[model samples]
Target: MIIKTLVHIPLYNKATTIVRTLNSVFDQNYKDFDILIINDGSTDESLELVKNINHHRIIIHSQENKGVSATRNNAILFARENNYKRIAFLDGDDFWCSNHLSTLCALFDKFPEAHIAATNYQLKRSRKTIDTVLSNFESTEDQLLKSFFHHNYLNSIFTCSTLMIKPEIVDKTGLFNESLTHFEDIDWFVRIGMKSKIAFSFRVTAVIDEIADNRSDQVEMKYRKLPDFTDYEAEAKNHLGLEKYIDLNRFAIALAYRMENDIRNTTLYQQKINLKNLSLKQQQLLKMSSLQLKSLKRTQKVLGNLGLHLRAGD
Candidate 1:
């Protein structure tokens, strides 16, 4: 499987870490790839810093201050035009272990039919560390539709930087949604994951530098996973117009409301039926909302007495 991959690094005000990030890519154990650096309207000397690296294989694309989604969209166009089979990404603030590419290559070799591969990485703060694990998945469209009922499997994987996907999948997934300011990855992943299997790399070959101000880190808190349901629920309801998706959205909103102690929103979301107008399952779902609401309150009271404060619903 001697295919070429394009590693797109989108840079903005990452002057402090851009060099290290690029160095890590050059240090990759597997070298059959081209590095494309998109200097997205950086006012700092980030571009100058990148030029000092002196790598011939690196191609630089400069644009005035486009957002990440746009930068990535351009990179995809470049990869497609150049005929790259695989596309891997590294944010300017993150760096990968030497074996990052080799590990993904090996996985793709093993699963010829797989369209995407992702690896587990260390989620790091200034000095502390949090470990997360993601596994490779092979799912059909039907299984994916069902999984959405329980949870969004792809989001647990975290960060687009960890994913290595085929170009065709990117094209099919329609690149990152330009309008979203956050959870863009989740939106794109759920769409693509519905069509292809996602595989995880068992090795921890990347370091996701979760700086204090980093968007995800700033929004972090203990017992925070529950609030995440709101974003997906909204995205599903508004962006994806499938009826099955509406059912799943109700279930998720119900969970988020339960977490935030909002019984009313919880019940309201739970009561919607999917009809000609709504489905029978949806009608049944509305009926059970009250029960779920009561149980949620009971659990919250126990937790509150035990000294846990619920953050307002996200």
Candidate 2:
């Protein structure tokens, strides 16, 4: 029998959460799907736990520590070879609600022209659940490229785990860029949006566990060491025809650099963007701040004390 959908999970050292993720997949209301768990060199007991699941529908592939992008690309290749019509992703540390797959499948059925389908999701941070909508728009709608660009910049509407796409679309759009250690999903979404329309559902049907040791946190630390926006800038102009928003992109990048205390690049990008909203004095203050490493640490400490936190885009 031909599988209707394939759920691709890229696993690492997620021994704590892998079982929950698999159980969520098995509990899905949509049953016409198979799972591909790509174990990316997890030193933990993640693989052993997965083997004990005793599910025929699950296929496990183990490879030496390739990054998330490469692991996902491997799953894409597997989906193609298996003749699956649709493909979805669920990370080892993340899980879907029972109706998540069914919701996306129904959206595809309703809007055959849409190559991509996404739903709302919740972020679980330190025992708090925050429900997030893709955009401020209505609950269900078919979004065009222009609308998507306007509503989002770097981060996508939904997280990677909440997205479903047709195999043909993947063929046309190509695989995820293995070079990008972060924001690969953003780059992939931008490419997909440029090629086809997207169907979105406002129902929160997935949960992202934003733990301290997650890849996003590590990526933020890496950004502090070295920040670069060349790839994003090229994608905005070359793929999405978002030349006008280049300055906006620069502004966002500048903010990221500022948060990282990389004031040199931040000031460079700020000057290049030259946003009019900031008064001259405010701009001067930003440019002239000492930006000492100790001061940045103190600022972070203050924010933590005040219960303020930062979340990555998407």
The TM-score leader among the candidates is 2
- Give a tens-digit lDDT track for model 2, residues 1-314: 88879999898888888999999999999999999999989888989999999799999999998778899998888888889989999887788999999999998888888888888787776678776533235435544334565544323467789989887787677888777665566557656766677887778899887763454544553453222444455555454434423444455445556667777777776776645633343344355444542365543332232222233321
Per-residue lDDT, model 1, residue 233, is 48
Would you list the C-alpha lDDT of every candidate in the order shown? 0.62, 0.69
- The backbone clash count of each candidate, in order, is 9, 0
lDDT of 1 at 271: 60
RMSD of candidate 1 to true structure, Å: 9.0
**What would you estimate as the lDDT of candidate 1?**
0.62
Model 1: per-residue Cα lDDT over 197-284, one tens digit each: 6555557788877562223323432223332234344444444343444444345445445545567666665665243433444344
The TM-score measured for candidate 2 stands at 0.80
Candidate 1 stretches greater than 4 Å from native: 1-3, 133-155, 212-314
